[model samples]
Target: MEIKLTDQLDQIYQDARTIRHHVFVEEQGIAETDEFDGTDSDAIHFVGYVNGEPVVTARTTVTKKGVHIQRVATEKAARHQAYAKQLLEYLLDQPMFEDAPMFYLGAQKTAIGFYQTLGFEKYGEPFEEVGIPHVNMRRTHSAADHHDR
Candidate 1:
């Protein structure tokens, strides 16, 4: 599967949102109010596609410190398929984010090691986010990491 990054109206945006809503709201049981907070408008979103069908979503926003990645989700049928990883890798390759000083997120505890293997390092003590345990993790931009991709 190939992942593509796009703006809000590419139809993939809706597909991405469907994955997010399912993963975060329905399956995870997060409240609709908390899950659908209005920040997507200003952020860049990505969707992973398999044979032209979107199946995963992830996004990032540039901040004063660096790029902040968030909202990674995969449709139930697409879990374990490396789709979110593809979305994240493509996101990191974008010109606006590729050379940022850092990329970071508050990752769910279950996925911490997954991000760690991808170069993110955990920093803070774990805390609850969306009623799930999460930890702050960051990946400092390194030429070697970029080269590997």
Candidate 2:
């Protein structure tokens, strides 16, 4: 698998769109308006490809405190194979996020356990976002943190 970073929409836009389409539009019935926020223009995106096929995609926006991970998704056929996990790992490894004090993501209720396995801890109470229950989660990084895994 190879992970690439690009700001040009042409680079990975379609792949990211496809993942979101599969997960939100086709699978969850979310309207297109809710999926494509204006944030993409400023956010950093990561695309993971397996054998030249785009299998996973994620985006992150850096703030003063940390990087916020969002829009993480993998093609249905790529589920259970750790493609999303690998994409996240690659995003966290980027130099821009290397020294971030913490990494945060708004995780879907059903997917909380997966992020927990990655060291993210749920914060406060769960709330609804776009009609889906979600909770804020964050992972603080320390020198001793085993991020390699």
Candidate 3:
């Protein structure tokens, strides 16, 4: 698996869009207008490829509160390949976010277990986003704690 990160949408825009289209628009029935919120231009996008085929996509943006993770998806055919996990493992290796106290993501209810395996702790009551049940999850470990584990 290969994980690539870029701020330039032209780099992985098509692959990312394709996966998102399949996962969000087609499978989940989220409106394209709601799924594509026009923020890709400024976010740090990640695309995961398996044997040269892009199969997973995610993006992160820094906000005043914390780093917000969004649009994490793996192609339905590639779900068991762990491409999304690979993308996140790559994030851990980056030096920029080293001492952060927390990391946050709004996890789809069906994927809560998946994110928990990566150290995110689900909190609050379940809420709906994009017409799907979701809950906020926080990786409560300090950066050092996460890396050490």
Identify the candidate with maximal TM-score. Answer: 2
Tell me the spans in candidate 3 whose CA falls farther than 4 Å from its real position: 141-148
lDDT of 3: 0.82
- The local distance difference test score of model 1 is 0.82
Cα lDDT tens digits, model 2, 53-131, are 8988988888987999999988889899999888887776677777889999899999999898777889988999889
Give the Å error, residue 105, model 1: 0.4
Q: How much RMSD separates candidate 1 from the native structure? A: 1.9
Error of 2 at 39 (Å): 1.3
Task: Give per-model CA RMSD.
Answer: 1.9, 1.7, 1.7
- All candidates' TM-scores? 0.91, 0.92, 0.91
- List the candidate numbers ranked by TM-score, top first: 2, 3, 1
Reference-based TM-score, model 1:
0.91
Q: Write model 1 residue lDDT over 1-149, tens digit each, in one string.
A: 87766667567778878888889999999988887688877778888888988788887888987899888888888788777777777777777776689888999999998897778889979899878999999988784276478
Give the whole-model CA lDDT for all candidates, comma-separated. Answer: 0.82, 0.84, 0.82
Tens-digit per-residue lDDT, 70-130, candidate 3: 9999999999877888897677546666555567899999899988778788888889987
Candidate 2 Cα deviation (angstroms), residue 18: 1.6
Q: Could you tell me the lDDT of residue 17 within candidate 1?
A: 82
- Total clashes for model 2: 0
